[model samples]
Target: MARAYGFVEYGGPETQQLFDTPVPSPGPGQLLVAVRAAGVNPADWKVRSGRRTGSVTVHFPAVLGREVAGVVEAAGPDTGFRPGDAVFGATAEGYGGYAEYTLVDARAAALVPESAPFEVAATLPVAAGTAFDIVEHLEIVDADTVLVLGAGGGVGSATTQLAHAAGAAVLGVTSAGKRELVESCGGMWIESGDGFDARVAATAERCGAVTAVVDLVGGDVLERAVALTRAPERVVSVADPARAEELGGSGITRRRTREVFEHVAALVERGVLTPRVERTFPLTEAGAALELVESGHAGGKIVVTVP
Candidate 1:
């Protein structure tokens, strides 16, 4: 039996437990992989908490991870990957990658470059993929100024770097503690708080009117960010779709494919973007790693390694 960390019920951290799971078989267009690393994100806990009702089907004894970097163990019919190929991708079934073995859709999987390590590859699927989607949707241009809310976290950090690489000036909103981290990614840090809009406006006037706002922080913060843009439609959120719609913006519409994964990987290869992996935990300590993300104190990506 393959060991895995997961939850038997929808609840808080107390619900998480380690258990033995059968090594999953690959479905058509999928690859069964021996997982080396998995990335942890807020969505893992949000779904685990039962707060994101109906967004996904939760099978009890659910393995809880989305992204993985691993060696292929088997390839399903029509998949191009071979056994022993080094690859990374989003889990074909969202709840599987927390296990020692999981399946990744061929369409979402990519060959890992020789220069990229498993931990770095693990960070791309959700955070960098989502960042790419958000930036692509905005179609940010040279001379544009884009403001990223919650810029210290994984997605925000990737967004900052990718936008900066596209020749746009990046203004990042994050806590004071993360100012250096955000700035290091070529983003101008704006401390998040009350009157952040005025600060954004002042910054924009000095550069140019904010052309786009990428909201990784939702609710009221997102609502306020919409005003910083010249048009609400230029504001998009990954956090709050409902609030975004009310403000005339919308949430990111993701295109999950191997092509997208390869593009983000290429950015990493080119040194145009970097995945800031702050900490890694063994599979046994998956709960603690997730707790740090849930606490909202994590400075960057948190990864779980499989033995």
Candidate 2:
């Protein structure tokens, strides 16, 4: 039996617990992986809390975690992976990454680059992957001015770096504590709070007109961000699609492909992007890792490591 963390019902942190289960067997186009690291994202808890119930119907005793990096333990028919290959990507639905072993869809999976560590590769599937898609969708240019809301977090930080690498001037809205982190990634920091639009406008005057915004924070923040850009179509929100639609914008549409994974790995290898994993918790302490991500205060990415 493999040790794993999961929830028996839809609820809060209390719903998550550790248990023993038989190691999952991979079917066609799947791989059973000995998990080395798992990424913690707000979406994991959103699903656990039933916030996405209308869109996602999960069974009871659902394993919780979207992406993982590990060594392939077994491969199913039609999969390119073989035993002992180091790979990272999305986990199979219901059999997730917060465990000793999990199944990954071969189409969503890719081999980790030689220079990347398991922890860094672990962060790619969800956050970095979305960030890559967002940048591509925005079609940012060298003369464009980009604004990133909640820019200190995983997706936000990745967006900032990718935008900067594209030669766009990035203005990152974040807490005062993350100023250095945002600046280090070639973005200017804008304090997150009231009057965010005014600040964005002022920064645009100094840099260039705000051409696009990547919203990781939803609701009022996204509403304010819409005004900073030239057109609502240039404004995109990863956090709230409903509100974005109301404002003539839209949420990020992810294009998860092996090539997308390869692009992010290439960025890291070339030093154009960095996967900043702020902290790691042991698999037994997975609950603590989720708590940190759900609190909305942690910077960079939070990862769970299985020893």
Candidate 3:
């Protein structure tokens, strides 16, 4: 039996419970990981709260984590991975990441850098992957002034790094507390408040023209990005699609995002990119971690560590 973080109801972190389950065997094309860490994203809360829908909508009680890093404990038939290889990747269907063991596609998982910690490598799947997708997929390059709304968060932080790597002039919007955080990723920051528009306009004015907008903040923030964009197609968001559509934007498709992940993984291997992890919780404390992530004030990322 394996212990995991599960929830019987859709609520905040308090609803999550530690439970037992049979350690699942990897099926064909799958690798079973002895999970060291799991990256906690806002999507975990949204899907659990029923705001986001996907192929693995919970029918029974479910786990709610996504990205995971650990060692390959077992490989299913024809899997290329061998036992004891350190790996990391995005987990699909149910939140198996909040456990000591979970199954992921062998092809999708990347071998971790020998020098990186399991905790840091664990942060890459969604944040780094999505950042790579947005910058590369959009072809943001030299002299491009890319506005990163909500740049203090994981995806936003990672996006800033990727955009800077391509010589884009990145501008980040964040609360005052996060100014240093965004700047470390090579972006200038705007504190979100009453004067947000003025701050944005000033930032744009200095950059000459806004070529792209990667909004981590949806709702009114997307509208702000829309107003700032001189090229609509270059504007992108990883937020609510319904909200995105209301502003004449669309969601990032899965296939294209894969290319971004592959490109970023190379940067990670070269030691040029680092995923900033804000906090780590035990698998049993997933509930508390979710609360922090949902509070919209996490310094960077929250990860769940399993023994």
Any residue pairs clashing in model 3, and if so which?
none
Counting clashing residue pairs in each candidate, in order, gives 0, 0, 0
Could you tell me the lDDT of residue 43 within candidate 1?
Answer: 90
Higher-scoring candidate on lDDT, 2 or 3: 2
Cα lDDT over the full model 1 = 0.90
lDDT of 2 by residue, 111-166 (tens): 99788899999999998999999999989889889999999999989999999999
Encode model 3's per-residue lDDT on 112-171: one tens digit a residue.
Answer: 766678888888888888887777678888979988889999999998988988898988
Q: Supply candidate 3's per-residue lDDT for 160.
A: 91
The ten-residue window of minimal lDDT in model 2 covers 55-64
User: Candidate 1 — which residues are off by over 4 angstroms?
Assistant: none
- Candidate 3 lands at a TM-score of 0.94
**lDDT score, residue 149, model 2?**
93
- Cα deviation of 157, candidate 2, in Å: 0.5
- As for lDDT, the candidate ahead, 1 or 3, is 1
Model 1 pairs in collision: none
Each model's lDDT comes to: 0.90, 0.90, 0.80
